[model samples]
Target: MTAAVPTVSDAEAAVILARCDELARHSSLTDGIERTYLSAEHAAVNYRVAGWMTAAGLTTWQDAAGNQCARLSGSTRGLPALMLGSHLDTVRAAGRYDGILGVLVAIAVAGRIAASGRPLPFALEIAAFGDEEGTRFGTTLLGSRAVAGTWLESWWDLRDAGGVSLREAFLAFGLDPAKVGDAARAPQELLGYLEAHIEQGPVLEEEGRALGVVTGIAGARRFLLTVTGSAGHSGTPWPRRRDALAGAAEGITTIERIARAEGLTATVGHLRVFPDAVNVIPGKVEFSLDLRAPDDADRDRGWTLIESALTDICGTRGLDLASTQVHEAAAVACSPRLRAAIATGIRSTEPTTAPADAARPDEGGSDSGPEAPADDAPRELPSIAGHDAMAIAAITDVGMLFVRCAGGISHHPDESVTAADVALAVDALEAAVRALAADYPAL
Candidate 1:
């Protein structure tokens, strides 16, 4: 027998997209002289979102640590609940959709469910996590980490670029820094979590697909490299001179070559040279390197190649070199059950559209493309960037749905998405949520 198909109405999808666009203009997660953690502007956006949640028929409240939550109780008492959420913070000069879309979409979905007058089997909680951007405090996912009980005490003392401590910022926002532990929830209390967000990349648009069933979050390592060599007069003969800038340039080129050859993604995003004079031979250079892969072993192998190349280049060029690790996070695989549920929902809701491509064919299943058998689903891709879902994954079963982004441009003022794509994503999410609610009823 064929599985029952679940679907959402076009009207419902439109309502959700309208709400998302409305919220996007307000938080403008992309705007602020600087909304970095603890800034007055950041706090304002948080409070505004909380108010919007309350208006949407949720019992919204702000935690002692400033995290915001909006609760929607189901008919089943004492049943494990599902959390749907995403962050509200943005990177410096970020776009509106990066983190805000997921949270607002959750809110709209919950509102739709409530308006239907059908009592859900399990309760749903919508959260708008704070400070995931790490633009300030130099720490990411502060709100979600707290909820998962993974936040460290040392986090309170962490400072921003301006040397303002997290604790100071918390107090300034009228939140108690010492009460952070209150954010943790019993793992048993949360049955699962789901997030719907923009792809923030070119994949979906390139493939002409409306949805991306996330397979896993990629592993990443961030480090800084410094190349030092003697400064010399600009007119000095090339034969007898040591150029730190030249060595750093060679290192950059080597990194590009290695990453391209290995099929790994490597980036040298930031670079600084010493000395203020225009003609001065640079004595020192510092650059940040970020490398990511689908798994730890692959990520490590890429880094090893990078290190070997750097050492060889520095040694042969008579330049001193050093490296420091800034941050590292391992890849996370989504639950198999959740992945299947999302794909099933997508197929059921939009029969005319193709099924999701299996991200890792060997592990998930075969990707037969559009011509594949009806039983086969397209492959889902792994996301290299960090996401709010990562934090939730640490505590409970988590799944993600990606909406197509226009030109893969994110974290910029010009970031945008089409109205039709937004509607399609909402339909997929609604169907997915209803299916999960039925299959994984509160116990």
Candidate 2:
């Protein structure tokens, strides 16, 4: 049997919040956070995280892929590790706690376990992945991909907004580009991975819960769609004009309609129209399509429906349609054993003040306060956003814990999490570690 999980004191919660604030100060933006991979800010954050890792009683190192990693031994020397951590990178103008909280929570878990002085069957490892957002190079999960042994040779040529290649950035950051392959780990070397992250959506908050267990990460497919027609004077008669912009407008509306009807999330975030002048008819229109679903087959079906609709619309408008898929990432399902462990952890950390269930209309519901449900059934939801765990899933089983974020907002400066929630998350994470040790004593 495993030992009792440690209680997360107020002091520990304060330290985690303080560390998050400190990391926020190292961002490229003065007004907001923007720490990209391999940038100067990236190096600074890694150095500080390494110091924290050592303080937590773990040996530290910066892996070849630029991830700051630390590990604590278990019952024996050189045992396969159970990895716990999240990405340390952020999007442009990002919030302070999205990925940072997960890494700090992992460190706290390790520290608490180390303080107990109880040996385990597998090693406890923390990996602060360097690049999960891919904001700098337009390719996500670079750090996790390397560790998963799925690094692609084409990534070296990818360029940043400043025209710097990934290879060049690695050299400038003092990482040997040629040694990047060394970051890869065989599946046999790891037991599994666990990440605790903010929900980045309104589900938990809406449900009046502080925590939830992730069911899976959504699979995503991105496409570049273009509509072509002949440009003409604005004065041209409508019957003679083949307006691509009009068709694009119709296409966008149809995309939203199809997504809503199909129960998927589809976004057309970027759009460009040629001859952008107000007095000229647009000859061409281009837009980006990002579609995500909880399952691969579902997502593919939605895409097919979307494509068919767009094609028909464009044809009706006498416009030519073209599309190319730029990126695709498969969905990742969490490990069932780890999922149960997390659920158990949530129950262990349940606050006495939890209010009534929000699902029941008779229950008085308020978005501002936590609602304790009548049952111990922790809500399980799939992550609509991408994460490092999705990449690491290529190598080992993975699980995630979702903490409620204020307003379900992320990737923005306003992103926020309550101190009470953080405290609860730490408690849950510590319990999860203990539960894992008990269930998988043989590693």
Candidate RMSDs in order = 6.6, 5.0
Model 1 bad stretches (over 4 Å) = 1-34, 351-379, 441-443
- Work out the TM-score per prediction: 0.88, 0.92
Candidate 2, residues 1-443, lDDT tens digits: the string is: 67534345546867888899899999898888999999999999999999999999999999999999999999999889999989999999898898999999999889988888897778999999999998999888999999998999999999998899999999999999899999998999898899999999999988778899999999999999999999999999989999999999999999999999999999998999998999999999999999999999999999999999999999999999999998899999998988988898898877532332322111243312454654758889999999899999988899999988878899988787766677778888888888889978554
Q: For candidate 1, list the clashing residue pairs, or say none.
A: 30-94, 356-378, 357-378, 357-379, 357-380, 358-378, 358-379, 358-380, 359-380
Best by lDDT: 2
Task: Tell me the tens digit of each residue's lDDT in model 1 across 85-177.
Answer: 887777876666777778877877788777778767888888788877777876677888888888888887888777888888888888787
Question: Candidate 1 at residue 427, lDDT?
Answer: 65
Worst 10 residues of 2 by lDDT: 353-362
In terms of TM-score, which candidate is strongest?
2
Position 151, candidate 1: lDDT? 86
For each candidate in the order shown, give its overall lDDT on alpha carbons.
0.75, 0.89
